[model samples]
Target: MEAVSYSGLRKNLKHYLQQVNDDATTLLVTNRDNDDTAVVMSKRDYDSMTETLRIMSNPTLIDKIRRGKTQIAKGKTKQHELIEPDD
Candidate 1:
């Protein structure tokens, strides 16, 4: 993690981005008006985070997770429930 003022980021945006890509570094920008701002990885990280959120949002997955908990409570299933295909 690194801290830089807003002006510093604006002045050396390219350099900061280089650091981000090369080292997976984070820059925290601070200002009097805005407490903190972040500059992070590019679309790769954005797409990955988006996909993760999508998968987590699936209702079927949510149901399976809840059912898994129930099965565990009742000692009715092992590590893998292997929920068969609905079809």
Candidate 2:
């Protein structure tokens, strides 16, 4: 994440917009008078983050993810090809 003042962002809006889109960078806009702040990020990245949050909110899925990480750390994982189902 990159931090920039409101004025700075407005001054270089085009450049920062490119950074957010191309580099998948997040921008934190800060204000002087107030504690208000804003974040800017790509739509794709935002969607991905929301999806991850949705998955994490499920207790069953969270447990499974934790177990998988433990198994990986214990070197109990195997290499296998993932076969997708035909539509």
| TM-score per model over all chains | 0.56, 0.68
TM-score of 2: 0.68
> lDDT by residue for model 2 over 1-87, one digit each (tens)?
889999999999999999999999899999985668999999989999999999989999999999999999999999999999999
Kindly report which residue stretches of model 1 are placed more than 4 angstroms away from their true locations once superposed: 61-87
Which has the greatest TM-score? 2
For model 1, residues 15-82, the per-residue Cα lDDT tens digits are 98888777766677777667466556756666878887987899898888889899989989646568
Candidate 2 structure lDDT: 0.94
Count clashing pairs, candidate 2.
Answer: 0
By lDDT, who's the top model here?
2
**CA lDDT, every model vs. true structure:** 0.79, 0.94
